[model samples]
Target: MRLFFGLDPLAGDKRAIDSWRQRVATADGRPVPPANFHLTLAFLGEVDERHLEALCDTVDDLALPGTGELRLDRVGYWPRPGILWIGPAAPQPALESLAGDLGRAGQAVGARRERRRFVPHLTLYRGCRVPPPAPAEPPDLPFRFRGVTLFESRRGRDGIRYEPVAAWEGGGFSQR
Candidate 1:
């Protein structure tokens, strides 16, 4: 399955992000559904069932740092990927550390390391012909990450959906 590790935002934060996306998204791009909104820590790509189990176990064994709030202030776009995203105005140390740890764990379990530096952001839209201009000011949204989720990416009649296969709360792993 197509797997990735990410942090799920609180319900209120998701609503706020969806509302902001509705305001800024142009008609040309496909806006990411609010339900699929998440801050990805590592992209594990495809993994077999056996490897998937091992990956989940690795996460379960990890000693995650305390949960923290991530302030997503800026709305920006990556021209090459044609993705519009929202992220913090400055570096978030706790978030960065979590991502780095996850990346290392993924590598240990045979997942490739992402070449680009980890820039924590939640994607708002994709496949845009023209990238959206950065917002003049920050969006008022604070995301409290309660846990890390291992998501399975599936394509259905509607579109792509990210289904949580397993989850690691601040304490331990749980089936979802």
Candidate 2:
């Protein structure tokens, strides 16, 4: 199955992100559905079913630290990937550390370590024929991450959809 670890934003945050996308996305760009909006922590490509249990176990044992409210205030466009994304203006140490821990857990289960450094962002649009111009400034949206989820990616009638398979709650403490 195609799997990844991620965090889903609250409903209000999703609406704010969608609103921003409507403002800057080009006609040719496909906006990510609000229901599919999430901040990916680790992308574990195709995986064998046999390894799934071990992967889950690894994540269950992660030592995640408490993080304060996260802000998705910066809008950015990556020309190479033709993706529009929203992210924080500055580095979020707690969020970064959680991603690192998740990455290590994936590696322990034979998942490939990503070569690029993790940049915390939620995709707003993808496959833009013409990249949208960067916004002059970011919108103000603040939220707390409630949990980390294991998601299975699959092709659906509309397009690719990410469905949550399992999750671990986070609220200034670790949860299995």
Cα error, candidate 1, residue 53 (Å): 2.1
lDDT of 1 by residue, 1-176 (tens): 88888988888889988887676645357889889989998888877767877777778777764466888887778877788888888987776787888887778777878888889899988877786765544587888876788898999999999999988776765675
Candidate 2 local lDDT, 87-111, one digit each (tens): 8889877778888888888888778
Off by over 4 Å in 1: 25-27, 65-67
Best by lDDT: 1
**For each candidate, what TM-score against the reference?**
0.90, 0.87
